[model samples]
Target: MEKANSSVPKPRKTSVLSNYEISVSIAFKRDCEVFLVEFAKQKTLSYAKFANIWQLKNMSYIFADQTYVSLLKTLCEECFAILTQCIIHQKNVYMKIGALYLLYGLYYKQPIEGMVKIRVSYDEYTIIKDLMDEMAKEKYMEPLFIFAKLKADVAFNYVGCSMPRSIRFIKNTKKAFTAHTLNANFGENPLSKFEGILQDESVVKLQDTCKRYEMALKKNSSIYPNIDQFKSTIMDDLNAAHKKLFSEDHSTPSEQIETDLKILNSRQEIKLRALKSENATYRGAKQVLTAIDLE
Candidate 1:
């Protein structure tokens, strides 16, 4: 038999995220869910404008939250995996770059107003190297290699490690090559930012949701209030959250039910109904989304 051609690159098999990675993706997706719920509740702005509010700078609470250390620890644990999924598995460009920029920012994230910035300690710097070479094997990912190189250099610098200067990419890149991404403004994509905002898969979805809501607001200027109220009922739409409460297996408790339903008007009634629905559900946002997301 004739040998298969060696020149052609074989198709890359899709990488499956591990259970840990899946859990991370889902936990990472949690805030997005909450934003989506709130965004859908908003009858105030267009999608583009609405998305601006969700930016990390605007979300001042995250930096100040008592869980900041825990959150940073979690991101340090899974950021490599998150980057891998974004580069190899994620198809949405904005989501992909959002991951890139966010990871890049975390490397040098600065403290502000006594709230700590993102960091992986010297002991944890090795995490950045875990999947970098694997992702860099392909030529198209050269930019990613350079991105990783820059990040790794920061780690080396942080630890006061000295490195020799080296020759660079010459054979592969063309003289005409230039990064012209919208964010680049005709320059190479920095892939990192000094004071970047928080962005990720969920943010992108929330932005899409905003676009959808924006259209609805324009289409139903008067009825959008009702639409927003109806949309708020999505919390109970998750089956796992209400499994025992609504199932034949169990009976819902009355106090578990918020018996204190007070309504001053029709709007209050709608909101009260939403509050009651939320009360009946018993799962955290991460757990709810994790149960539904494909593994």
Candidate 2:
């Protein structure tokens, strides 16, 4: 009698790509084939080539088509492998830098989780990381400084805080007058009392330093300014902000405040550095592309 009450098992669920997704996959594969053909001949990638191969429309398909996603992962791995080889073999610096630009573009295009994991031996990872670090240390600072300014805006928004009119005034001041004006009037303003409450040192320093870097970059377009300047400036700003926010006289800060501060300092620094390095590589790629007519 109990056997008579048994129910039928349900069928396993499966996903299928839509007709549009299938078409996207076909178009993407064709593009990859074209890119591979060019890559085979030149043994390097360029910004224009990469932009042509990786169209914005194709990128939109990555999330919708599992097959396309897998294909993209495969493509990224192949490019990364080429990058590793370029570095390991000590190939032409221009080619190596070009490969790096392509790799960064791919890595930044989609979410890391969606992309294939970079499968590298520990030693390989170390070598690549070291190279990247060296490059970052010597990267142009203007882009990073600009990123820092944007980071400050995001950080203030994170903690539901807004800059005072005095800070805004400092930001809008002419570059020649900014530093002097800030030094003289910063502490005297009524808003200065709220600096501790607002935790605006990082924002202020970021804007000020960005302006300085902008001027410097404009003056010396050929020189690759060291990124260490930005790091030092931001670190000092963060330290000052930290001391103000958690003065010895104050009670222990809440976990949220601590987390936000960490994000503003560490995460923002990491992001700015990465952006700087990527941009430098991209610029180098453009130069190399111009040197060698791919047509």
Candidate 3:
């Protein structure tokens, strides 16, 4: 009789997080209630705007809170999972960038006592690497590059080393390219000053965001041909409509002024209603409304 064939089973892959790690992650997420509440309250703010406002207005009180350092430390530990969920599951670019910003602040401001280590399983590492690659191909270049750079910084800092200058150089190049495109497109405007009053960083960060968006649009131009023409057409129509509405018909100066004021007020009210509806629909539309009450 022939000998029976024998086969050996492959070992199953396990999670990178240990039981302690899992427990700590759960506790940390629970502790994020305060952060979540703050986020929801200001969910309409852009990440940069929110960060700037928090730094100027609330940083001191937040630092004095007993749970602040602990929350930062927990976030540092769980940064990978948080970023992954934001990028992959939630598809929220702002949240992904926000999580990285939180991790970056934690690294600089509140240093942990001992060596804080992050260990990734082979499978998990592969998943992250693939995600980064996919984002790169999709022209989501800014966040993809930033996340990679930040992840390396977090990992190396935990082990008491600096990331190589070469990696930093590459990341900076990507950021500059996006920023340059935006600055060229928008030019300088008096409107930036108006935006600065509520959130000082909004204007600067908005330029950067616009550059990234412009690049994305250009990359997918085949699907959105005549976008620039469309914008010009809309602006021309708006200007013509405005001129028709406020045309001076040889009325008395005071009467003309009063009529103009009424037209402006009516237009402002319509804009405010539209802005509120937009805020309800989008995550950060309120920040776009310069006339909204920031208080």
lDDT by residue (tens digit), candidate 2, 124-191: 54565566565568773432343244334331122111112443233321112121221112223343
Candidate 2 lDDT = 0.44
Show the colliding residue pairs in model 1: none
Give lDDT tens digits, candidate 1, residues 1-295.
9999999999976322233334555554444233333333333323232334344224333324434554444444344333333333333344333444444444444333332222333433443343344345533354365466555565323332211123322221112211221122212222222112224555456656766876677679676456552343332343333453344433222221122211123456787787789546544543445555766
Candidate 3 per-residue lDDT, tens place, 237-267, comes to 5446545644645354334434655666677
Q: Which candidate, 1 or 3, has the higher TM-score?
A: 3
Q: If scored against the real structure, what TM-score would every candidate get?
A: 0.25, 0.26, 0.31
Q: Show model 3 residue runs off by greater than 4 Å.
A: 1-47, 53-93, 113-115, 151-295
- Residue 155 C-alpha lDDT in model 2: 16
Q: Name the lDDT of candidate 3.
A: 0.45
Could you tell me the TM-score of candidate 2?
0.26
